[model samples]
Target chain A: MTERVYAGRPRPGNNFELYSWFFMRISGLLLILLVIGHMVIMHIINNVDVIDYDFVAARWASIGWRAYDWLLLFLALLHGANGVRVVIDDYVRRKGWKVFTVAVLYTFTFILLILGSLVIITFEPIGMGS
Target chain B: MYRGGEGQLSFILHRITGVGILVFLFGHVADTFLVGFGPDLYNHAMAIYRLPVIRVLEVLLAAAVLYHALNGLRIIIIDFWPAASRYQRAMFYAVGVVFLALFIPAAITMIRPLFH
Candidate 1:
């Protein structure tokens, strides 16, 4: 027998909740590092004039930057989407609405993430095919 | 409708900021494409960004990017890592500490050069 002191029903497992909470802080710290690295290389290195289409082409030519950007894009979307999911749970009282909205949100988030990653990793910066 | 102390406020603010960043991202891409228009047009457009007002705006933009990105990381920490949830409040303050430590110095160094 368990003493029920709380008003609302308790969340089952709370696995998602636990992970979501941890993700925000960790990702935020990492974003600071990522953004600083990006800005230093892109902006402060040789001034903005050096960055042309050729510069972009040369940079993305490397797998290192591709992965860096991939990490950034996915982390950003997931972080933002999880925040949105929490908002839906907090405000949308109807159970059906909550499920529907979260599903749509996640779908969009993942689709964008996948598409962006593909473009970053496989992009041929010049007009011609590689 | 959100009350103080509720995590909901943070979520709402974050969504707004995220949307803002998305818009900013699109505008940035479009501006990059504008560079392809022509050298003269690109130079003129780039020149507009060098004005005093634009410089001020850039500073604000930098702060916005930093704040959103940093606070966002905080939200993630609280969401996924239950083991650290106990220290959420302390962790939030730690973010502020980190922000100030970097921001203050960066601002001073950035401005001093402009003045001298």
Candidate 2:
């Protein structure tokens, strides 16, 4: 009984929490590759200095890079959001505060997903047209 | 199992690094979104990243990422094979060694531009 002191009240649901746990592990594995590949390509091989407008334009010109980046953005945001949800559940015991914090987390995640997908999907290479 | 050991240290660091990466991810997405506004606006923003101080922070970010990813792997191993829980302390150190191996080279590359 004492061991469960820190565990948050388990809300009865359709295995939502179970799914969240599973998602973190799976997404973490995928991100290990996606993110490291991204870092190696952008930061090591090329360096930040070369990553400017034209560089982005050229890279996004390829559908493959666009798809890869879109997947990274999607997975990273959802994985991070769920991870924070667990943190909030653990620390924010106050009901109102927890609600507000989770609300903010969800709202931020939703807005960013939309904004990021828009940028990736609607991108037009410079010099092609306005 | 005890709170006064590597398990606790890994847990704390995991939470810290996860939150830190989330904050950075938010900023990264917002900044990347600026590419839609045009090159002048985007490159103007990229100027901030070229600062020497930001270069150092980039190295720290790399360290945080490597630590979090490696430690998360440790957690997954223990979860899937509970029998391996007995060796988690050793796994924690292993995670550290691998983190340093990968991070040192990446850190050097990340910060080398600052020296040049």
Lowest summed lDDT window (length 10), candidate 2 chain B: B1-10
lDDT of 1 by residue, A1-130 (tens): 5332211112235887756665655665777787777655654453344555556566778988879877877666766677667767878899999999889878777666666665675566545243
- Winning model by DockQ: 2
Off by over 4 Å in 1: A1-13, A43-50, A92-104, A127-130, B1-19, B22-58, B69-101, B104-116
- Cα lDDT tens digits for candidate 2, B8-78: 88888999999999989999999999999988899999999998889888888888888988998888887
Q: Is the docking of candidate 2 incorrect, acceptable, medium or high quality?
A: medium
CA error at residue A61 for candidate 1, angstroms: 2.2
CA lDDT of A105 in candidate 1?
Answer: 79
| Clashing residue pairs for model 2 | none
Tell me the DockQ of each model, to 2 decimals.
0.20, 0.52
Error of 2 at A98 (Å): 0.5
